[model samples]
Target chain A: DQQVKQNSPSLSVQEGRISILNCDYTNSMFDYFLWYKKYPAEGPTFLISISSIKDKNEDGRFTVFLNKSAKHLSLHIVPSQPGDSAVYFCAAGKGGSNYKLTFGKGTLLTVNP
Target chain B: GAGVSQSPSNKVTEKGKDVELRCDPISGHTALYWYRQSLGQGLEFLIYFQGNSAPDKSGLPSDRFSAERTGGSVSTLTIQRTQQEDSAVYLCASSSRAGLNTEAFFGQGTRLTVV
Candidate 1:
């Protein structure tokens, strides 16, 4: 069973435009959500994350929005750049910080310069 | 290095052969986890170790897969009589602690190819 799902396999956007990636989860017990970005031949790196209590969290150009009632979340990269192209995975965990995370299949984002 | 380290970045082994993958987590992190990403698939949890507590082996795909952390630092994941389906990029991660506020750091991953 895929508790976390990123339905889109890939997305393409123009540089300096807004890029949004969506994710949905079936497990409501998951209270913490995270986004990770991976480049070819490299391990995934943490991006932005949001806690259940909050609806949005922003760091520089990346922002994450969580809707508990919808069991969904999205990562928005404003003014997307070519370097932002990569595979983005959505992960969720229960019991807060020290929990095992369930990951989505990932969505590959390509930004054209 | 400040980041998690994984050895044998690439390994090609014949089917039925056993393989051992190693991981060295950040120096002070106490929570270690193992995950694997198959081709066109998401990261699948494998196992987890936290301090002296019993490791969580629930995510292991089969009896042929096993991992152990020695001295609470370096970890080794061993696959016995591996199958082609076992080929994937095995990743290791570590966190200062497992809980609400900590984030895990991952290694580059060991890519295993079973031919």
Candidate 2:
């Protein structure tokens, strides 16, 4: 069973535009969510995360919004740049002892210059 | 290394042969994990080790797959009698602690191809 799902396989956006990536989870027990960005032949790099208690978390140009009731989360990059083109994976995990994360299939975002 | 390191970046093995993949976690990190990623598929959890606690092998797919962490530093994942379906990128990650709040750093991954 896919606990986390990223329905969109790929997305394209023009440079300087906002890029939004969405993710949904079936497991309500997950209290923490994370986003990772990966390039070809490279491991994923941690982008940002949010706690279920909060609705949003922002760092620089990247922002993550979480809706506990909807079991959905999204990553928004304002004024997207070409360097932002990569595959992004959304992951969910519980806060306590269980550190294992359930990840979505991933969404490939291409920022066109 | 400053980050997690996995060796044998690419390995091609014949079916029925056994393969061993290695991982070196960041120094002083006590938590380690293994995951598999198939083409167009999401990362699949394999196993986890935290300090002296019993390793969590619940995510292992089959009995043929096993892993060991010696001295709580380096880890080895062994696959016996590999099958074509076993071909995938094996990724290793390590964190300062075992918790959702800590970020896990991942290695470049070892790509295995069973022919």
Candidate 3:
């Protein structure tokens, strides 16, 4: 079963606009969430993360909002640039255990210049 | 000084053959993990290793797949009797500690193709 799910397979956004990607998880044990951006032939790079303790975490142009009750999370990039175009993966893990991350199918975000 | 490094960026092997993939974690990092992404699939957790602790092998698909971390610095993932279904991009990652809410650095990944 897919514990984590990214319902959207792909997303397209215009430059300078805001891009939002959403993810959902079925495992209630997951308390930590992370977002990674990946390019072709490259590994996923860590972008932002949010602990269950907080509802939101922001870094520079990227922000992640988590809703534990809903078991959902979203990543928002303001003033999206072409460089931000890549596959975005949402991963989650349960704390204090082995905490091996469970990943979603990933969303391909394309930004138009 | 460097990030996680995985060797043999790409490998092609025939069915029924055995393949060994290697990973070199960042110096002093105590946590390492292995994951694989198959075609049109999400990243699948394979195994995990922490400093001196019993490795987590629950994610391993079968007995054909096994991994060992030696000296707590390097890891090798061996796939015995490879099958076409085993084809995927295998990724390795490392973190400073285990079971913490910290991000793990990833390697470029090793693409394995079984024909």
lDDT per residue (tens digit) for residues B27-67 in model 2 = 99999999889988888889999999999998899999999
Candidate 3: where is the Cα deviation over 4 Å? A96-98, B99-103
True contacts kept of each: 0.64, 0.49, 0.60
Alpha carbon lDDT at A49, candidate 2: 85
**CAPRI-style grade of the A/B interface in model 2:** medium
Interface RMS deviation of candidate 3: 2.5
Off by over 4 Å in 2: A95-98, B100-103
Best by TM-score: 2
Across B49-80, the per-residue lDDT of candidate 1 in tens digits comes to 99999999989999999999999999999999
State the displacement of the C-alpha of residue B68, model 3, in Å, after optimal TM-score superposition: 0.7
lDDT of 1 by residue, A1-113 (tens): 88999999999999999999999999989999999999998888889889899999999999999999999999999989999999999999887744577889999999999
Q: Write the per-residue lDDT of candidate 3 for residues A14-106, one digit (tens) a residue.
A: 999999999999999998898889999888888888889899999999999999999999999998999999999998988635357888999
